[model samples]
Target: MSYATALKRAARHNPAWKAASVFKVAVEESGAAVLDASGEFQYDLAEDTYALRDFTQEERFTLHQPYDGDAALTVITANDPNSDHLILWEGQFHKILEVLGADALRGTVRYRVKALPQDEAVPIRHSIIL
Candidate 1:
């Protein structure tokens, strides 16, 4: 429904994410020179709401390398999910990447991603945290 909702869903399997902060969202551009128009995220970690900042020319390309390009979110965690043993949640974004071939969000890609082992899902509320 919303980015906040998405994060909450992503958090069920990642309790550490409960305190995680979404800092940035970078997309892959088609021109090969990552633009800054695709979309940006407004984060309120304490409340768990990540909204689109604005629509613009998406940024892409890292001339330094290929495949190294990634659509990623910079996160500040309360603790290292892996080291803390709370990183049970597997990342499904890669699945989308696999299906889309790493260029799905070219114009604007919309899809719902679910965490594996469905049972881990829990109800979440929108609020600003972290």
Candidate 2:
């Protein structure tokens, strides 16, 4: 068998690689939208079509100033090509900034993601009319 196929089989059967934890991967799409009834606009979310897979947090560390904050490195098994892989973990969104994989090791890929900045709290002002 080919090296890529063999690597995949090895990783899949590896006991250390747990398949319990689940996470969502949002694939970026470049296309236009569609118009529906009442002139409402709609687009393919692709939330339902994307595959949910197992990933393990290999490492996490803090980043000093002049750079963004904390970051997490994870390992995921997929034969997908090198591209941006958006991840939704624990209600927080993250984008795969880097990917490391080889053709011989097709099903195993490492991703480094930095958490996207969340919405800031808006202050409400109450003015007094004298």
What do the candidate models score in CA lDDT, each in turn? 0.28, 0.41
Provide TM-scores for the models: 0.19, 0.39
- Cα deviation in Å at residue 75, candidate 2? 3.4
lDDT of 1 by residue, 51-70 (tens): 12113433555578765433
Best by TM-score: 2
lDDT of 1 at 129: 36
Best by lDDT: 2
Clashes of 2: 0
Q: Looking at candidate 2, what is the lDDT of residue 26? A: 24
Off by over 4 Å in 1: 1-45, 53-56, 72-130
